[model samples]
Target: MAINRILIANRGEIALRIHRAAHEMGIETVAVHSTADADAMHVRLADHAVCIGPPAAAESYLNHAAIISAAEVAGCDAIHPGYGFLSENARFAEKVEAHDIAWIGPKPEHIVTMGDKVQAKKTAGELGLPLVPGSDGAVSDPEEGRKIASEIGYPVIIKAASGGGGRGMKVCESEDKIESLMSQAGSEAKAAFGDATVYIEKYLGNPRHIEFQVFGDGNGNAIHLGERDCSLQRRHQKVLEEAPSPVISDEERERMGEVCAQAMRDMGYRGAGTIEFLWEDGEFYFIEMNTRLQVEHPVTEAITGVDLVREQIRIADGKPLSVAQKDLEFRGHAIECRINAEDPFTFAPSPGKVTYYHPAGGMHVRVDSGLYAGYSIPPYYDSMIAKLIVYGRDREGCIMRLRRALEEMVVEGVKTNIPLHRELLHQKDVLHGDYSIKWLEEWLESRED
Candidate 1:
């Protein structure tokens, strides 16, 4: 099915990203938006724009019927849910397919399988991926959990089976604390994800968050782009990302890249996906997989020179991957700082008018944003307003370029985390790329004391 026109079923920089790719591929785009986003950059730039509903996300962005209706009315041949809202919704993917419209994402079954943490871990292990040692599946029995904790050694983490974002996670260092922590984790999981099921895994004291970018044609063929180090996070939310991790060697990358690609091929996966791992002591442990394009994809793009969005559209059109494993090459180092509309230090959301906006500009600096001087950022969505990405020949050069870029960036009216990113670049640990997943939170804590 050739995708002549695509309905972009998302908002913000990602939607604009999709629109640019579709246009580059000679495919027209229809931008769907809430009333609040009618004046958005993507909406204004798209070939066609449709107002789905009101400002509230539930009444608009998450409204499946309204989106499908808009797609049909716009005569769109495909729907591209760009990394949020309904992007990973298996039911929504099925609904689009039922309507005879191409779904520019992973297959619905793959989404379903990977959406659940326990099932994803099971499948990853079956596909020959190394997993953190612990319980096989959801463990409800307190005594069973105790036994597993004792066997796996102490300091095991309890996590929700149905969701992530650190909501339903607890760490127990001793055997006596397993039952209480399990109950607490289960309660939190039930409240956050509507599922009380929780699983157990051996706790890694300090690990770097490493994820590989992979693409599949849904025909038992796949390729991995490389790995991104996302260890700089706050509350499990990524703050900055970089490609060709400062630590991973070329030999390790090749070894792990093949392992990841083979897993995708074994599953008959499709579209863009990320396989996340916790790296410690020179070994990688599988965590979970995101069956959709990630927020930190730009860094990978900068290093690999691959237009992921364009590849997604091509794969949806039943085309084979443009670049093969042998042809793929990692060129340089790239870093992306997620600039959010918030208090840089306190991390509080700040949504309002953009009094002034001057994004960083240079040869290797790319700013993905939808803000303008007079634009009003509505308070109804995610706080992230921009992504500042920079590339150079090496890690040191990348950081130097990124520092210069950050110095030039100016976003007024609404507060942003620009200062946080600037501070991070100055840290010795960050400069040496010797930080763990707990680095940011601890750094922030030290700032207060």
Candidate 2:
């Protein structure tokens, strides 16, 4: 069956992203928006729009019933969750498929399996990937966590099974701190994710975040595009991303890419996914697999020239992958800096009307945004307002182009982190690519401004 119309169960940039991809392929789109987002760009651009609910996400974007109903009423044959809200929610995926609407992402089973930390680790290990030594299952008590820590060596990391963005994670340097940290982690996990289950892993003090973009047709055929270095982050959230990791060698990329492709095929995975790893001391340790499109996917798209959203729609329409591994080629270096509506130094939200907006534009520069002059950034959503992406013949050239783009960009009324990004780009360590996941936080602390 082919999907002629898809309902976008999302808002802002990602919803617009999906709309663009679907329409480019001559497909129609239905956009669902909350009261706060009634005038959102996605709704304004889509062929059909529906008001789901109020500003509160629980009653709107996260409300499965409302989204599904909107899809049905709008005559959509498929629904695209667009990376957040219910994007990785297994039950949501199942419900969409059960209603006879194609889920334009990985299968529901894949979502459920990979959403659990312990299960995801086991699955990745079974796929022949190197895993960081840790607990084989969920550890609810301190004794069990301590035992796992002892077996894996000290300085272990306690994590929530449903953790994300660095929440419900604690570093225990010794057994003395295990019990307290375990209880804290569990409590946080329960409150944050509605599940108290926690797990443990060997903690690497300094590691680079690398992920490979993979796709599958659910018929044992899959391929990997390449790797993206997402080491520059704050509090486990990526602020900047680049493709063709500066640290990985050509041989390493080939080996890791093959492992990712084969693993997807073995798992019978379908649609776009990212296999993340922690690279430390020349070794890649499997972290977890993101079963949905990542927020940083634009950098990968810029380098590979693959429209991943379009690929997801095609795969959902029961089409096989149009390109093979050999057919894919990395063209140039690409970088994306997440432009956020916040106080750059304090990192506090700066939500209000955007009095003025001027996005950067030039050869090899692209800005993916859902904002314009007079647009009000709702406090109800993520702080990110746009993604500034740039491509060049090489990494150095990409940096130069990105610098120019950042300077040309301007957003007024609400403060933005553009200044922070500009300053970071000028730093010697960042320019030299001599940093890890921890580097961004430490750099922020060191800033006297």
For lDDT, the strongest prediction is 1
- After TM-score superposition, the amount by which residue 77's alpha carbon in candidate 1 deviates from its true location, in angstroms, is 0.7
In model 2, the Cα lDDT at residue 146 comes to 79
The top-ranked prediction according to TM-score is: 1
Locate the minimum summed-lDDT window of 10 residues in model 2: 139-148
TM-scores of the models, in the order given? 0.99, 0.98
Segments in model 2 whose C-alpha atoms lie over 4 Å from true places: none
lDDT of 1 by residue, 69-172 (tens): 99999999999999879999999999999999999999999999999999999999999999999899999999999999999998999999998889999999
RMSD of each: 0.7, 1.0
Q: After superposition, how far is residue 273 of candidate 2 from its true place, in Å?
A: 0.3
TM-score of the candidate numbered 2?
A: 0.98
List, in order, the clash count of every candidate structure.
Answer: 0, 0
Q: Which stretches of candidate 1 lie over 4 Å from their true place?
A: none
Q: Candidate 2, overall lDDT? A: 0.93
